[model samples]
Target: MEFKWSVPLIILVLVNCDLYSTIGGSTLKNCYLCNTYEPSEPESRSYSSESSELVGILVLKIVHLTLNPNQPSQATAAKIRSCCGGPVSDHFQSDQFEKMFSNRSSLEVEDHEIENKGFLDYQSFITASAFYQPYGFGTTYINQDFFGTKEVAAFLAHVATKISCGNKVVTREQLSRDLCYNKEMNSDLSYCDEHYKNTYPCAPGVAYYDRGALPIYWNYNYGEAGKDLKVDLLNHPEYIEQNATLAFQVAIWRWMTPIKEHQPSAHEVFIGTWTPTKSDNLAKRVSGFGATMNVLYGDLICGHGDNESMKNIISHYLYYLDLMGIDREEAGPHEVLSCAKQVAFNPSISSSP
Candidate 1:
């Protein structure tokens, strides 16, 4: 999906323009440049000729920036390509994907209660993944022998675990219940944090409950994701549930993005892109699948001494690795797979990303 320019960038431009006009010239009139232009409104056309020219120049610059972002140098692009491995679709086939979620997608399952049956498909996942492939979503190479297949498995494992309706029991039958729900069930909570009232205010009557493949929650998360994805999720968070590709896209985005500045993203942690600091080492937050969990869940799942929630997520990862024909041993030792000793990167008391 096409994304509009970020709100912050636009706001910065407007603020700069306002400052410039206040200092020397007549200010621009309130006019919508991106949306429908009001030529008939007196306020829209009331700006001085000099201000009008300035506004016109600013608008052109904004449009140009939006359409023609600066491209990386050839050397940088080549280096990125070398590290990103190959296309995910080339490594992961559609049939294998369908097989991985056969019970969830099949009508024959005895107790299947999928909210959106057959909605989550391989094509949608591939399409969503394609958008992030350039950024090394599932294509980061760890070494000459090992490519990004393991990272792909790790990401999908999180997606499967979040969206799945399967119980905590690790059985073949229970595993079949994966991908059963598109959104959180029976949630009345709007998940609007008062802390971000000015930055990401809760929309009137809109609920930012858990939704999408990886299930993002809260107004700040929705607002941030909306800004990154350019989807207006603050007002219409339901768009995630409505669009399968978008849902996967949002999930992948969550995986690729860091919750806080100076913190490692799940992708970075999983693929060894992020080096652990002395603090992280003291916290027992090493780089691996365990660190990925630490990055995503913090103390909720980590540093809890083998919690069921943490184990369940790990089980899903192993299960997906097996389904994808990768050895479970590649996931590393128990310490690398489990985050039972890692401290929270960002505690729950603070605003969660």
Candidate 2:
């Protein structure tokens, strides 16, 4: 049986221009599709049942189409490889990962914290990253070479910021050293939504609160992620902290996918896959790192002048760039690094905190 998936419409416009005229900008054919390649010896990688299930679901998510979960589809694999462009560079290194999370081991492990799975080790994260290469997120930056390094650094910065245990420190000097914050510390209300109960009911004893590197809150989010990731995250919310590989995979998935429909993925925003419309231009939503924040955090972080939360995440990114031996100066202008002037692509009520 052939499984059909929905891919974005490729618009190819042809025009016949006069040889002597140079009126409007010429329509350059932007090449997007790539030559297809098959995964060699995929069985060599040991993925758990949950991780294995994710391959099919992830393919559907990347292709924006539907396919059978049980069968191996060469056709599907070929299409996915085409979207991936060229071979993904081994841009990240284990030592770089260790340096990034060097403080994780020292993070406070509360005696009463039942879900603490200890610090995420560099080897574990590196292994997990390798497992997810098939998800098409490995080279999400429009087939660029070293651009993957920037994306990875930017991604790790958000991961560090969200799970950082450095929230108590006030001084900048103290805060930079406070990078060892891991584990989600919130213990408030459960983030489940009753409206989505039919589709993503709150598991009997689970609280779908923020957890993991890039946390996924609410029953709907957990439900959606669980489906795409082939993990029962709704019922096993604790699985995030329990498994480093799963945690990293979940964060990468969040970074690569879109939060809503008709919008670009955070990866797309960072890699310049998205072009702003007139309204977006008016809102100052340019394609860059700041636009990525606006997409993920919305009004909670963006449009607020010099907000500390937004700055913290940005600081982490720049800091990671420096640590990764990439010039912090290459991060770009303040407008692209800070979302203080840009309107949220998905703004919520009460922009003011």
Candidate 3:
């Protein structure tokens, strides 16, 4: 017969989930009573539902599945908790990419004119951007469409700041906060570690100054990234500066990999998978955009009170959010957006890998 829920309660439940999760497509496999739906199960896909009411939901799922059989049901259902808004297919496109790095051509001119120099052409850039999917970069914590977008933007903000040849703080307020390059200009340091020379020997004449999107500086970092990406970066650290895709890959790889075995990756920190320990709380490290800076930059960006460099990175993130048409308000409170008071998770230099 009929469900017992009141109209207002039903409305609340319906609005809470993505429309597709309710009376939309075949996102309702559990309601597939007459079919074999076992094989469609995603081993990694966990359910996000914890509804107090079930009767109305079941009816809605059945009605929706019966109505639309080919609406990418299983995929949508699996990502129920994704970044919440925007079309996933339209999340990060080439046009939007150009907007993020409009000065790519000029930046390249300042550096050197090479073919398809680092993120200038959208076609190659998009193709190479897929390296993060398998590493659990965008889909790890929450699966909102905007999650990927925001991650991309925040990451690119760091890249843009590091690679930028123009003024650091433009008149535009948002441009004021981009994360800078790991490489300090005019530094003669080779970043070669004698300790890892046996395991990851530095290539002769191949000085491992900071390179890549986020700029992996140390010989150890180059060796580790090379092993993970199947690229011999210790010897060929220039590959990052030469190829746009590889540069993005190195950065995304760093974001995905943790600083230490027990530490959380920048991705985890940004996506809320990282729960702060008592030490972390004492250090004021909580999950959000702010923790990402701590994860990536450590003492370089965090711990110092109201540091301009840290604020610059935060501004870049907010600018990118605005460019993506997302409200900067979603980034949470000031502490979560700035790690000024938090203790560094791992110091920039560590004895361990």
lDDT of 3 by residue, 1-353 (tens): 33455545534543433332321122112211122222221122122233212322232322222322334457555645432221112366656666666655544244443334333344434434433332334323264323666777777776766665545555453253222232345658788989998999988887888776677788999988787667789888887765655776677777777877677878778877677888888988999888888888788778888877887777778888888888888888998888988898886544223
Worst 10 residues of 2 by lDDT: 11-20
Candidate 2 Cα errors over 4 Å, as ranges = 1-89, 107-118, 131-145, 167-183, 186-188, 349-353
Q: Of models 1 and 2, which has the larger lDDT? A: 1
> In order, what is each prediction's RMSD in angstroms?
12.9, 11.9, 15.1
Go through the candidates in order and give the clash count of each: 1, 4, 11
Candidate 3 TM-score to native: 0.68
For candidate 3, the 10 contiguous residues with the lowest summed lDDT are: 23-32
Better-scoring candidate (lDDT), 1 or 3: 1
Q: In model 3, where do residues sit more than 4 Å from their true spots? A: 1-89, 107-121, 139-146, 173-187, 347-353
Stretches of candidate 1 exceeding 4 Å from the true structure: 1-82, 108-113, 348-353
- Scored against the true structure, residue 345 in model 2 reaches a CA lDDT of 80
Predict model 2's lDDT versus the native. 0.59
